[model samples]
Target: MSTILFDKIIFGPVHSRRLGVSLGVNLLPTDGKLCSFNCIYCECGLNEERRTRSKLPTRVEVKEALVQKLAYMQSEGIAPDVITFAGNGEPTMHPEFGGIIDDTINTRNQFFPQAKIAVLSNSTMLHKEEVFQALNKIEDNILKLDSVLDSRIRQLNAPNSSSFNFDSLLKQLCRFNGKLIIQTMFLRGEINGEHIDNTSESEIKGWVNALKQIRPKQVMIYTIDRETPVKNLKKVSGEDLEIIAEVARKEGFDVTVSA
Candidate 1:
């Protein structure tokens, strides 16, 4: 079995195909993960056993650890392209998310003033005032919207409950005023006997409509490149990714493809 890449508060300045060398900060616990969506493609594996009230690292803990690691990296003349809030699970799920963002910004500026702070969020908590505020403060607020169709979204993302609505969620995302970077994962597969494919014409049309309404600054289109928890998942080819990128660009949205 392959070991998990990110299982701690400060894990990497690992080379990312999209974000370049990123120093990761995981707000979720080292032992187990916590997230709103148990995505089939999540590298962290499915949230099988919930530890909802587990002790997440405090803001001070994150700040101190990150500051120490960052200081060491700087002294060694190693600079990361971005300090990312992405690891075992959703960073926004942390109770002190806002404070942690503030602390990261302050500390990172003191060290590598040039590195950007990015957060990879599932967009489920965008309705929360604190989550919205914290996301707005980050340099790269990359949010996920796999598909706009409610049925497909529920099937693909496997969100925690029935209360998750994609339409209303898009409306909330539109309020961001183009400050967000929307990311969509393109994949084709069978999950539990259901044909799980987002590359269909109808599905892409719905996604395009949602992108038009949200008007995000950029759209990062990519497919699975790692071992997914769910078997039988097919990776979208680079050619198909380019085609999707072209479709988004024609709609006047900035698009980047990572196949």
Candidate 2:
């Protein structure tokens, strides 16, 4: 079974395929996962295997740890391209999420004001006014939307709610007014004998139309780059990702391909 990948609240000035030289801030416990979706292609492992460890960190803990880390990096003369909010679970799930973002911005301004603040949100919390406000304050606000079709979303993300409103979520994303970056994962896979592939022509056709509605500033098309919980899954090729990116580009949207 795949276990937790991020073992600390603040981790790495590591290289990122999309966002360069990132320092990750994990709001959830390093040893466990707390997420709204149980995606088969998740690098942190399946939800069941992920919840057996540490508790979520408090807002103060996050602020203190982030500040300490930033200070250390400053002393070491290490410059990060971005301070990324990503880890084993959703960053917006934290109780004082808006407050946390504010603290992070303050710290970033003090230490690495040149660096960008980025959030890898699942878009589940966009319904919350505070969550939306916090995300809007950042430029690299990456949001996930694997598919526009509800059936495909269920198969791909396995969201916590069976009542996941497809239209409502899309509308919320549209509210970003093309300011958000759309992150789409393209893959072909089988789980428990069910074959699923979001790279199909029909799916892409609908997805392109959906992009037209959301009017994202950029669409990040990527395939699985790490081991996933589901062994049957396969990553879409770089060439294929560019093909999908081209479709979105033709629709008048800038895109980044990370295959």
Candidate 3:
């Protein structure tokens, strides 16, 4: 029962095998899913099968629908390499999410001032200091650590917070000192019979030792490209994500294998 929902509060410029020509921005409820992580490799599914009576899009309606879709994608010349705060759920759990990321960085500085403003966050709202200063005023603050083991993030990210603390979320991702961007999602699964894998080998050596204490400037591994509300999930290849991205590119970290 997978139900991808992004009924527009400024939707796609699509095409993103890792954020290229993105443009999505649904501050939850174009009708359901308000995530604080219900991720069975979610593509807008799961979270009680998408339920919403709707109401979470007013920061002046996400800066006037992102200034009328960046002024109609700059009059249809359509140039978007990333405006993505992602959709259907968890756009920093919107409560005026830092004034809508300061009106999408002043409407991406009046029409795609060299794009890039991403947010796809699941680092459980970074203990909210205005969502950690609006994800440190974005430019792709990706964030999401699939498993540093809170029992494999409560059986693969089922975190609705029973005080979900992975050492206080790795000290709030080591306070983003390396300017975040560590989005992992490797898979290998099962559900009612318990059997999952975060690309094991001790879950990529404790997620590359918490990315060597959150020194992430980039490290986005991928897997399960859509359609997963929980079936016999298993898609971690592209040469096993470049062998788990060469164990974080041999710890010098700038990994980005997307598969």
Candidate 4:
């Protein structure tokens, strides 16, 4: 039950293996986790294990902290390549998510205009109009679609909503119309005695087909890079990821693989 929580609203100009020089913004409670999907491979650990009594940062607080960090970075001649919304959990869960995005955009424009605004979301909240529109406005709306199969998705993502429909999710994603980036986590192993693997032939076939239909601008495939809540999970190999990337490439989608 290992977990990591961002202690501040704005953290890191840390080099991200996928996003590069990134600045993180955590909209969830700093001391706990709040996410729609209780992903077994989440670096932040199990949602229940990391539960807290803390409140989410206010929109004004987020904007002020971001501005302060950006201003100091400016003085130190350090510019972030991207301002990423990802930390303990689903950032869209915040009550003022849309307002926070608006504030972030204004603040980013004032400091690092060249930097992109990216949100790494689990894609459970796409049904919300405000969340959908806010994601559309960002440079990188990286949404997770671990598998095309409903059964596999349930096992891998463990989405909290009973109303979550795989088919409906695909439709909502299609609305992005190539504006979004689809990010998949590739891993294999057993969880609670059930064997799981998304890198299988059938799994890859179905996933690639879904990608073709959704038609995202880019596809990012990566394996677990940190300590996960589930200890039995295994990281997909670099060679295996390249194989998956080729399948995606044949579909005419730009793919990036992180092993």
Candidate 5:
């Protein structure tokens, strides 16, 4: 089992393929996970023991810890590309998510002003006014929309019962008129002996329509690079990812392929 959960405040300046040298801030509990969606490809695995409420670090604790860590890093000549809000579960689910974002921005600026603030959101909380406002403050609001089709989304993401609308979610995403990066995980496999590829004609068409509607600044099409909780899941090849990128490019969207 992976013992990477953070019970405290700060955890790595881990090497990330997309966001290099990121200092992770896991607002979720260190003991277990908390999230709105139980994504099939989530590195944290399914939220088996679901909690009715989110277990997260207090806003003051997070602010103090981050400020201390960042100041130490700066003094030691350590520089991170970004301070990321990512961990065992969804960061936005924390009740003080908006305040935390504000604290991170203020604290990070005092220490590492050059480093950017980024949040890797599952997009489930976009409907919340506070969540939207907090995300808007970040430098790179990287949101996830694995598949636009309801069936494919249900198959791939397995979102909680509360978050079931794929169309409405895309419409809400369009409201973010900032440096938005939409991430799509391309995978091909059989879940319970059923096909789960989102690149099919029908699925891709749904995605394209959503992309046209959202009009994100960039589209990041990438495949699994880490160990997934699901054993039957298959990783899409780099060539296939590039092909998808080509389609998105032709459709007039700035796209990048990272496989």
Candidate 6:
């Protein structure tokens, strides 16, 4: 099984396909994976394959790192478009996620006031009051909603929870009330002898209805951009993405397509 890890508390000034030049903050373990879902197309690879022994950064450590990194960037006259929360796993899984976001906001204000704070979550932890409140405070609160069908969601995200269902997740996501960005990963693949393709007509139709009900401020559709754990997976073409974008547009949502 193939797997990858961030190996750092704070990493990157890398170009984000959707968010532009952004800095990454990893609140999960620096050396291992700790996510609620084991996505087949995750660029970081399989969850069970994670092998790093590093631990999650403390709130203070994260705060200090942000201050130092931001201070240096400011001193050098460099500015990042966004400070994104994503790494090896679920950032909201961190015990002090709320406090860390608070620290990050303060540090960003002190050093890079122009930068926006963004968090990319799997949407599973929104049930936690602290996670919901913290996400509500951020400029970009991106939540993953990979498919509309519960069966498809099970095959795609491979949620750790046995009770994870599409309807319940959609209801939880609706709590954001159009304030969130819905991120969908488009791809075709198979796992455990089951052929999976979330870009199909039925899948797209289901996704459209879900987006309408959620009333997300924006929708992000993207395909696998890096080596995935499941090598059988196929990336959806750019032309095909435009076709999907039209469906989202007709559904009355701003769309961003990343091929």
lDDT for each candidate structure:
0.88, 0.89, 0.86, 0.92, 0.84, 0.89
> Model 2 over residues 29-82: C-alpha lDDT tens digits?
777788989888888887888774677888899999999999999999999999
Candidate 1 segments whose C-alpha is farther than 4 A from its true place: 1-5, 49-54
Candidate 3 lowest-lDDT run of ten:
1-10
lDDT digits (tens) for residues 100-130 of candidate 3: 8887898898887898898988888888899
| Deviating ranges (above 4 Å) for candidate 6 | 1-3
- Which residue pairs in candidate 4 have backbone atoms (N, alpha carbon, C) closer than 3 angstroms, thus clashing? none
What would the per-residue lDDT of candidate 4 be over residues 191-251, giving only the tens digit for each residue?
Answer: 9899999888998998888898899999999998989998899999999999999998987
2 versus 5: better TM-score goes to: 2
Off-target runs (Cα >4 Å) in candidate 5 are: 1-4, 49-54
Candidate 1 residue-wise lDDT, 88-134, digit = tens:
78888899999899999999899999999999999988888999998
Please state the error at residue 175 of candidate 6 in Å: 0.4
Clashes of each: 0, 0, 0, 0, 0, 0
Candidate RMSDs in Å, in order, are: 1.6, 1.1, 16.0, 0.8, 2.0, 1.1
Better of 1 and 5 by lDDT: 1
Which candidate number maximizes lDDT?
Answer: 4
TM-score of 5: 0.94
Off by over 4 Å in 2: none
Which digits, one per residue and each the tens of the lDDT, describe model 5 over residues 152-239? 7888888887556787887789899635889999898887778888888777777877888888888888887777766677888888
Better of 2 and 4 by lDDT: 4
**What's model 6's lDDT at 66?**
85
